[model samples]
Target: MIAVDQHPLGRRGTVVANNAGLVVMVKELADGDRAVSLTNETGSTATISTTADALGIANRGPYRLKDPWTKVPSTNTTGTISASVPSHATVVHRTAPGPAPLPP
Candidate 1:
């Protein structure tokens, strides 16, 4: 895909979560943003979650998340990044750092 090919997560990637049919990974982009990928391969829906600290994002706090497929933009203030993902689907988010928000 054009998007995937264009934006690549550098070599410093971390697998934040993983299991039989689900996987979550994150990496810091060249510009200091982040790429968080949540994948579901089973026959049921799944809720994937992780913290920015786990994602290796050491920024202050709040972060902006944008899903490439849906073009929906969201935010994270508690360092928690989560999503309700459908079966056999993958949600890739491009998160940009924002001003620090309150703690979790």
Candidate 2:
């Protein structure tokens, strides 16, 4: 994870990439707002959140996969902060499999 602290005003923070062809960008707004953006290599960007306090926000991105998703070059922002699947990406919940019965 890339940690950016005290980033300059009007400047973006750190950027990270994953094997899934996704790029994540962290931005520090001039008005003390923090935001996170996820973009594919194709240049499609999805903004996660823009809030003064990152701790209070529960930002969720659209990217979801059946396989495990890993973030390359782990990232973290100090001051405050918070997508890439798609504009229609929505939350998905999977039910757990039940235990098999013992043979009679």
Candidate 3:
């Protein structure tokens, strides 16, 4: 599952975590950082933090937060997070399991 923000930032990684307030490009990623690439409703994709707040950085994982499906990423600005991040928690954010089979 992935969350996509409907905003354009150059032409890089389109996939993004709507729950994340920041976006990233696939080319510039550090080792051990999990990123989810999402294409928004507008067809633009960006990389988003899969971890909750700073916890993603501390734990070396993607920034994962509450249910992102509940809301969409704000195109106006970086959405403010009402919740706080707890100490020492890591969540895995990766491509969904399995591959899409070609049409026979």
Best by lDDT: 1
Clashing pairs in 1: none
Superposed Cα deviation of residue 30, candidate 2 (Å):
2.6
Q: Against the true structure, candidate 3 has what lDDT?
A: 0.29
Each model's TM-score, in the order given?
Answer: 0.75, 0.30, 0.19
Runs in model 3 lying further than 4 Å from the true structure: 1-12, 15-34, 37-92
Report lDDT (Cα) of residue 20, candidate 1.
80
**Which residue pairs in candidate 2 collide?**
1-74, 1-75, 2-75
Model 1 lDDT per residue over 13-47, tens place: 57878888889987667666778888998899999
Ranked by lDDT, the better of candidates 1 and 2 is 1
Candidate 3: TM-score? 0.19
lDDT of 1 at 70: 70
Cα RMSD (Å) per model? Answer: 4.1, 16.7, 16.0
* Candidate 3 lDDT by residue in tens digits, 7-103: 2222234432434333322311233322333222232343334322332333222233233344433222122222222222222223211122356
What lDDT tens digits, residue by residue, belong to model 2 across residues 19-86? 34454554544433333554445434453432223322233222121111232323332222232345
Q: Considering summed lDDT, which 10 consecutive residues are worst modelled in model 3?
A: 74-83
- Between prediction 1 and prediction 3, the one with superior TM-score is 1
Every candidate's lDDT = 0.75, 0.34, 0.29
